[model samples]
Target: MPITTSSPPIRQPCPPGTCICNRDALLDNPAADPRILLLTQHEEKRLLARLENCASLDDLRKLQQRMEQQLGLRTEITPGHNEVRSMRGIRIVVHEQDGLCRKIRQSIPAAIRRGLERNPEVAYELLNEHDLLRGT
Candidate 1:
């Protein structure tokens, strides 16, 4: 009897300007990139509200951990030394090689607008509570 083995199939290159290959690559290793953390509008609103409700650095830290656990997105919160009651800075770290960071940044304004349109008073209250609303 002759010994024979089948060769592995070759992968064809994806067409130009198409994301078929990229999508397949992501499907193969979803955990390799944090771009999966992209949030829907509803999720963004809920997260923003939760952020606004944080009363202290401890609260913010807890929220950060929750986000990391639930969304796979890492965040850092920095409280101002002079202002013990407020979070002065927040950084959301993610892989930027694939433009996910820019996409998230660009979506913020639209999300806030939608939130404001849905409930102006609640939106204002949340933003003001977090010292994000100017001249309030």
Candidate 2:
């Protein structure tokens, strides 16, 4: 069996004792206004953020929720939602950017180049500086 949907049946008193129009007849009339599909409130906010360039971390999280529904993997997680939100998504390589870690598994070559330009001797000492900075 297939389910059918139409205008919902509403009970209204017949004026002056005339019978009310039957529900089946009302269902035959077309709807005055058709429904338009809409993005969820959360999704709309996310797109605005990307356009407006002022989205907070929390706003991104809401957008992420929507993307996770459609695109997936907007941010990396430590395995669960924290008590707080943080900036995540689309990793960027800045002229000088490195994760703070106990040991430098990856080196900031760009930063090293800048340092080298400052002093050729310092460029030669880049690895040594990393070892020293990590206190290893």
Candidate 3:
């Protein structure tokens, strides 16, 4: 018989955010107010590193404030419309019936679910690729 070898497993694109890797993590929580914030891998890493190196309570508070702005929550609520702030803090108003917001909400959860099924080893690979893991 001729000797044959299987090809290596195909790599997937890097997923955003921390994945809920196991059933235990999925079953462990019942939040009072359930919400999802979808962030990319780099964004999550930056958030974690910043949290670790916070200089003082004041720094921590400032960090929180900055995060709120970054998350697009630092906006005035006007009734009956969806309001988004531009980079220059100008308000861009859109109707509540806009499909873009709905699509965003739906897509994020789907992406997270896809992330849940990713191979566990991929996490290590991600850390390695980003140089977050060092010294073996």
Which numbered prediction scores highest in lDDT against the true structure?
Answer: 1
How many pairs of residues in model 2 come into backbone collision? Answer: 0
> lDDT tens string, model 2, 1-136?
9999886323232243343223234335465211111223354344434423313334434544664454322332121133212122112121211111111112222222333344443322333333432453
| Window of ten residues with lowest summed lDDT in model 2 | 96-105
lDDT of 3 at 60: 41
Error of 1 at 5 (Å): 38
How many residue pairs clash (N, CA or C atoms closer than 3 angstroms) in each of the candidate models, in the order given?
0, 0, 0
Models 1 onward score TM values of 0.41, 0.20, 0.28
- The candidates, ranked best first by TM-score, are 1, 3, 2
Tens-digit lDDT track of model 3 for 15-112 = 33433222233225554111123334455556556644544434544755674555432212121223222222212232221111333333333332
lDDT of each: 0.47, 0.31, 0.35
Overlapping backbone residue pairs in candidate 1 total: 0
Say which prediction, candidate 2 or candidate 3, comes out ahead on TM-score: 3
* Root-mean-square deviation of Cα positions for candidate 1 versus the true structure, in angstroms: 11.2
Provide C-alpha RMSD values for all models, in order: 11.2, 23.3, 20.3
| Reference-based lDDT, residue 37, model 2 | 11
What local lDDT score does residue 69 receive in model 2, on the 0 to 100 scale?
A: 59
